[model samples]
Target: METLIVLDLDETLLYAVQNKLERDEDFKMGSYFIYKRPYLDHFLTLLARDFKLAIWSSADDVYVKQLVERIKPAHITFEFVWGRSRTTKKRKSVTDDYYFVKRLSKIKQKGFKLERTLIIDDTAEKSMLNYGNAVQVAEFTGDPVDDELLQLSNYLQTLKDAENVRIIEKRFWRNG
Candidate 1:
């Protein structure tokens, strides 16, 4: 069974240099740019080489696409990038759950189930309370240029072994 790797955009893989929502035609104030955060390329490469990759950010698709292009440059195989347009004040609204759930449900519909699927997100607003197949990486508010990737890396390394997923669940959600 191919594992589905869903990732969040802002603050997970990339930090916004500028408020990404600034480009909104409806924005009365300003927005920013999404910049790559640490462990992004390396982790992405690892996922591409191992599990099937998909991005399920709360942000829109166009914004996510631009970030993907900027980061990978070369086309690394990705299953999908599930996202939505920034048009509301819903805090963490999702417009791509159809794609998100379908991917998982397909595995069930096809008579297969994941031994281990993973999600690396910075917020619980979407993935945590809803998806049982996710690991939330609590957001770190600091200079992006200085944040360390070791914590994320250590967790990823453990995922290579079937027995160590508890580390992911325990650590990711502050899961007590």
Candidate 2:
């Protein structure tokens, strides 16, 4: 069975920096430079074999589109893309910045199975709506030695035929 993998762009896959001065390994995406996580291309290729990919980001549409265009090649492209407007707006608890919640129910409404869907986000709060279906990761920020994706790919490979992703995620991906 093919699972749906919902990915968050910033922090999860890459870190975007607006100041060119701070960027050494730059992936130019319009006005910003994005630093893709280590082994990104290999990770994507692995995932493409077993699951349909989708990008769901809190960033604006234009920025998300530009990043996707730069990051994805011919063999790997998102099955669908969702941007800031697709997220649910929530009031800020401690700061002026409001939180954007990724409602997995929206994806479910579009016919993606909740049992087979897995959300990969760095922020734990982003998975509030579908906690059981999420596999949280430590936020990536241009670490050359980072092998989180490589490890995740191995874990996911074991769950390629899982009837429900939640059980596998809880068993193998929960906590530290």
Candidate 3:
């Protein structure tokens, strides 16, 4: 039973903001400043060992690809990479930024079953369509001490053998 772990880029795995500072940790990629979350590489390495990995970010292709390349090197593996083009176009609200939603229904069209798939994103609204299979983590904002990824890895390890991902997610959501 292979479980799919869908990761969000941008503020979830890394935080990209205006690069006007002189911080050595800041990666000036193109027009934005990107910072790797604390223990990012280790977290990815641990998760990749137990579950099939994939990236499903709302960022544009060029941006997402660049970020993925930086984070997951050749040795690290990813089953799929989906950008804004593959997501459902939906706005958070009238006054909110227009974000493409990660619709599990659409992902199912690509052969990924909801019961075996889990999505981790900072924005709860982005995963609203598949909230049961989503783990809403605290948005990564370049904090050097941030440990959300490590914590998430521990939680996922517990679910790796579960019959259904949603059952475990439901329990967490209730307690959360």
lDDT of 1 by residue, 1-176 (tens): 55556667667766665444333221111265454555567767766665666676666677677666667637586666656642122432465333222234433443434555566777654554336566767574334444444465555555654632323444433323
| lDDT order of candidates, top first | 2, 3, 1
What residue pairs clash in candidate 1, if any at all? 18-32, 18-33, 19-31, 19-32, 20-32, 22-31, 60-84
Q: Give the winner by TM-score: 1 or 3.
A: 3
The global C-alpha lDDT for each of the candidates, from Candidate 1 onward, is: 0.54, 0.83, 0.82
Better of 1 and 2 by lDDT: 2
Look at candidate 1 and tell me the lDDT of residue 114.
Answer: 51
Higher-lDDT candidate of 1 and 3: 3
In candidate 3, stretches whose alpha carbon ends up further than 4 angstroms from where it belongs are 20-22, 92-97, 170-176
The superposed Cα distance between candidate 2 and the true structure at residue 116, in angstroms, equals: 0.5
The parts of candidate 1 lying over 4 Å away from their true place are 17-31, 73-75, 85-114, 129-131, 140-142, 145-148, 161-168, 172-176
Tell me the TM-score of each prediction against the true structure.
Answer: 0.64, 0.90, 0.89
Which prediction has the highest lDDT against the true structure? 2
| Residue-level error in angstroms, candidate 3, position 79 | 1.1
